[model samples]
Target chain A: MNCFKALLLLLLCTSLPAVEPVKLTDDGRMKFTPVFVDGDTRLTFVDFENPKVFRLKSMDWKTREVKVVHEAAPAPEFDPAYSIDGNYFSFLRTTGGLQVSLVIRNRKSNEEVVIAPEPGFSGYRTPAIAPDSSQMLFSFANNFGQDIFRIDMKGEGRTALTGTKGINIWPSYSPDGKKIVFTSTRDGNYELYEMKPDGSEIKRLTDSPYQDIRGQYSPDGKQIAFVSHRDGNAEIYLCNADGTSVRRVTNHEERDDYPTWHPDGNHLVYVAERDGSHDLYLLPLKD
Target chain B: MLNIGSFKTKTCSGIGRRSFLQMSGAIPFGLGMSGLGMVTADEVDHVVAKAKSIVFVFLWGAPSHLDTCDPKPNSNSDYRGPFGVIPTRTPGVHFTELLPKLAQRSDKYTLIRSHIQSAPGHPDGGTVALSGFEENPKPVKPNFGSIIARHRGFRGKLPPFFSIANGVVMDGGRRIEAYGGGEMGAVYDPFMVGASETGKVNIPALALMDDVNPLRITDRRQLLQQLDSVPRTLEKSKFRDWNRTYQQAYGLITDPTARQAFDLTQESVKTRQRYGQSVFGQSALLARRLVEAEVPYIQLNYSRHVEAITPGYEFGWDTHLYNFSLLQDQHCPIFDRAFSAFLDDIYARGLIDDTLIVCMGEFGRTPKINVRAARDHWPQCYFSMWAGAGLQTGRVIGESDKNGEHPITRPITPLMVGTTIAELAGVDSQARAEMRVLDGGRVINELL
Candidate 1:
């Protein structure tokens, strides 16, 4: 489960040009949650200047062009996600500093409604839209515990997919919509887990002592990439769908997190810390 | 034997054992009368100390020191956080912009930037910060308030020591170790006056049942005393233990002073508005009233529970998630408004010279922000603001490194803080010996 492919690459040759991680954005602001790259090589992320003014910006890898798809909604908005068809967008908005509600907007109608938590729900974070854009899955924590849940776009058909006794977060749907991958602390420390859409027959993917969060599947759904703290600091790592052939992706001293797979599945983009500023970087997985 | 042996003995200030005996016109040096034994004025100078009372605002969850008293503006974005630095009334001293009010009133307090409590875990750190010792070795060290209560005893109708909250400070499942009597015994435990955000005061320890009124409480007390009169076969029983506790509760319920002190309606509309309507704000107002009531020691807990992640939930200084946002939106603004008004009210009311005010959290957040865009717990360095109690005002003591990670000057530990508080509150050497806590605790000479 713990294979150091990068160490092997280093041992094989010392003269090869360094696999430098590419910087995508130079802005020193926070790279908000839910930074993802779609199948079209277009990357989307919330550029957080502050709660009052944040923008969901996207950059095309092929053309090197950037644009803001939407401005953050009123109040503090975080973890923005765009629907596959680009008809709807979803994000988490906190009222006060505590009660969190999922906000979904219909682009065509210019209408928005807030999905508040049930009576005992206390916290919500990292909302992700389904591939079909019909349902949204997110993680919510209460006084009792934390788990992941899925709800329809109309605020109906809410289901607790993973109701384990520990924190489960960052649930992402596979491209085909048949499987879901997420990070869970149910086994003491954060590790990746893969399960069916309904959350049955779960299988542990990466078993590392340190935190392994934001486990995302590739566009082809053959591999999973996540951020691991096994190296004493957060760095990106990739593993096969069956939890084998683990390999390190991004190697940097400062913290690197939220890795998103490119359309070609051979490249990965993630937020990396350089000199105290957080910026997105594109890594070429050509080794 | 007048059966007054259980009462608090040992005269303090100009009151207590000697005063009670003198006031009662009892025979001098009567036999079989025993309690705190005997003490000389020289041994009990702490009783006549400068500070008549202390209001310890324990910010249970650690706030980021970089964002509070010790701001590093020259440091880059990572260490400086999101807020900018503002000049304080003290020349060359600046605090994060969130604390503009505290900044303006900097002339009234001593801002110590090199405070450190080594335990990073919430419960351990909170306990040490509040009590000056670790929670291990069975019974933990008594809190500063408990020690003060033990030596000073009750002054009037009000309890000697009081905590403002339903319960003591807790983080998740663990409570702070020094929240109660600890090694000094349960008699020193604070009589808590709980308050919600709406400014309602409820005393859970003394709260009578819905059907139990003042008359009913009296009836029950009489019945219990009657039952106690029926002599038991067991010769060594401590059944009479309820006498002092019951008397205190009855006095609180019936005394107009106690009720009036807790009543917020008595405050002027402008005064209440100045403190703001948040739970912490109202609690600060309550602390001022308690001071007027002459409570020797008061622990004004900012939050009932620590580690509150969401806004509408219980509030604490622990900002593990979204540290900057929460501070900007809720924690900082409330503290800035309430604390500033509290300082002004204390000074204007002429309580400043006698009443000691100390505000601080258990620890502090890390120097560098984490990947989650929030700061984690860093116990190496933090800050505390001290005012009144004859302390040197408009002064900044000690300094942290450039990044505010570690103290560059002499580090002030919780032990020093407890020692200073106890010494100023008038807990003399004799009382500290009796308490048996803070054995090696030394006062911060610079503070005095």
Candidate 2:
């Protein structure tokens, strides 16, 4: 009986996910919209330099060296996304007075396509590039709540993906490109939902009373990582691709948000606030 | 006028004569000197004082009244926005889902939804909100904090009035003209201090003496010993005055208890965690410390700038665009947690009875959703949260229309806010008359 109990204790301890997260950056500045690029050798993210400037920065994953991705401009740019082949990049740039335009630039041609809202207090948010780089998905305010919309590579052929009664945002395509997962408040309170590429057969992924946002598919498309506030404060949480077996990844009292999946399916890189200092950390997960 | 002299001296910590004098210049003893000459009123009528300290939490950018405390669940979606209303601890009082924590703590504070501002734009609105008067008429009035600070006079090492923020509050590039002493002259300007999310307190005036980092110095006695070596080159009487200024500066810089009051590290790990580690959160904690230290007034700012999405600006409550998104993701979460913790701490420390706390913005956002699906400036109606200071609690003080477009009940003006604050802080009508401040201001009788 003692030997059996010892084996059970060992199994339980080994099965528990690793609670210790390794700190990656120590500069302690606010960072947002982190994405892995260049075959996972570099990380691209937005760094807020001041209230008037947000610079897109790329870090060499190996040496930890950081550099700006673009020359300084008057308008602040953020919410960056890159095409799967790295041939195209998309981001939101503020024009003026609550107006933002989604700019998609083709690296090969240095040509750009811009999608802006009608003149007034309007802007696009969180552009997600399709896997084939043929389309871009973003959210805009419509009919009193934000709705997801997709535009082709040339910023044409706009189509409403999901028009709900509440906010529907942070849409990203699965690796396979057959389905899209996003956060929505249609049912009241932010929750994760998935639907086909054509916005059909929508299915709820999370049912938390609090917010569950920033959902992203793992590189291999088997898992999803997101930020949820169900456990009191905002923390990183993970669920299966089909939204089963949800588990909390971070338990800190401070906020842990903006979770982006590492190229490897077993880890996530997220912005974590610890002891009042916000920095990026690599959190490992157990199957 | 006393001429500042050039005297060479060095501290044990290697602070040179230039740095020492620079540090002294940052002390603002000249302002305090002027304060000392003001005649105290011999027979002024004084209101029964309930609060010893006042924390004027200035939410710089106006927040939407309908989306927050005055949620109109019965209204159309255009007016109600995306958030659902949640029941608060106070019966029939409801807030949006974005403020669950504050909703649960409703019993701790009174909510006023019938407040209105005189100005629509940020700079003018901010001036009106802080000083209870418009700026265009010239000779802008002193801030309520300034009025209270002058009435109380200087009594401690810490400045009687402190504005805890990154810098002077601004809207775009324009600074509110009535941010400080106003007509009272710069001498009565509240001392400026900035607190980072990590509890790193920065005295901006002290930054003039960058070479002398008083915050980095742990040994107060050693620093004081080093300061004693300055050469006394002036005549005996002049030297005596200079020495008094020096001692005042030294007392503020090297007083361990004074320094400790600004130190967030002195707080336990759990305590700091409760504040949630944001700029506004840590600043709220610092304001609580200032209150505990008996500072007469603290202007705790939410952000330095009014624009929420503008680069280089901290996120303020002005939600002209992406109002619902910003409120859901950033402003509301940070505010709900930090403010709830602040209220809990104030009550836990038994400071509620003697500390008057007022949290409000310059104005409120538009009741009707704008063309961009966001809210814009609306001076017609707004809301404020009041607690502590032995006042009533767990009740709604005023009412707004069903659309939150106008105050259906008696409109509470900014002057009424200033008058009520002053009344609670013991600045009665006679004191206001004597100071030539808050002219024709009347207290919100319903609050009393």
Q: What are the iRMS values of all candidates?
A: 18.2, 7.1
lDDT of 1 by residue, B1-448 (tens): 0000110100000123243223323322122222221111112222236888899998867888987888776776556664546778888787776677788889999877777665667887777888888787677888888888878876689888889865666665567778877887767778877664435566664443233344334455664554455445533323332445555666765665666777776777667657754567778888999999888888998886322334223338777664655575457766887899899999999999899999999888888755444577887788898999777788877667789986655667798899889888877666687768678887766566
lDDT of 1 by residue, A1-287 (tens): 13688777665432221467777776544464535554566777766543123456778868858887655444445677767677777887656444567888887797887888554324467777888888888776543345688888876787898874456778988888888898775665467898887878787888874567788888888888887766645678888777787777666655577787776777777877554345788787775
Computed on C-alphas against the true complex, the DockQ of each candidate is 0.04, 0.23
Question: Against the true structure, candidate 2 has what lDDT?
Answer: 0.77
Give the CA lDDT, 0 to 100, for residue B426 in model 2: 89
On the 0 to 100 scale, the lDDT of residue A244 in model 2 is 88
The positional error of residue B313 in candidate 1, measured at the CA in angstroms, is 8.0
How good is model 1 by TM-score?
0.57
lDDT of 1: 0.70
Off by over 4 Å in 1: A1-287, B1-48, B213-245, B305-315
lDDT per model vs. reference: 0.70, 0.77
For candidate 1 chain B, the 10 contiguous residues with the lowest summed lDDT are: B3-12
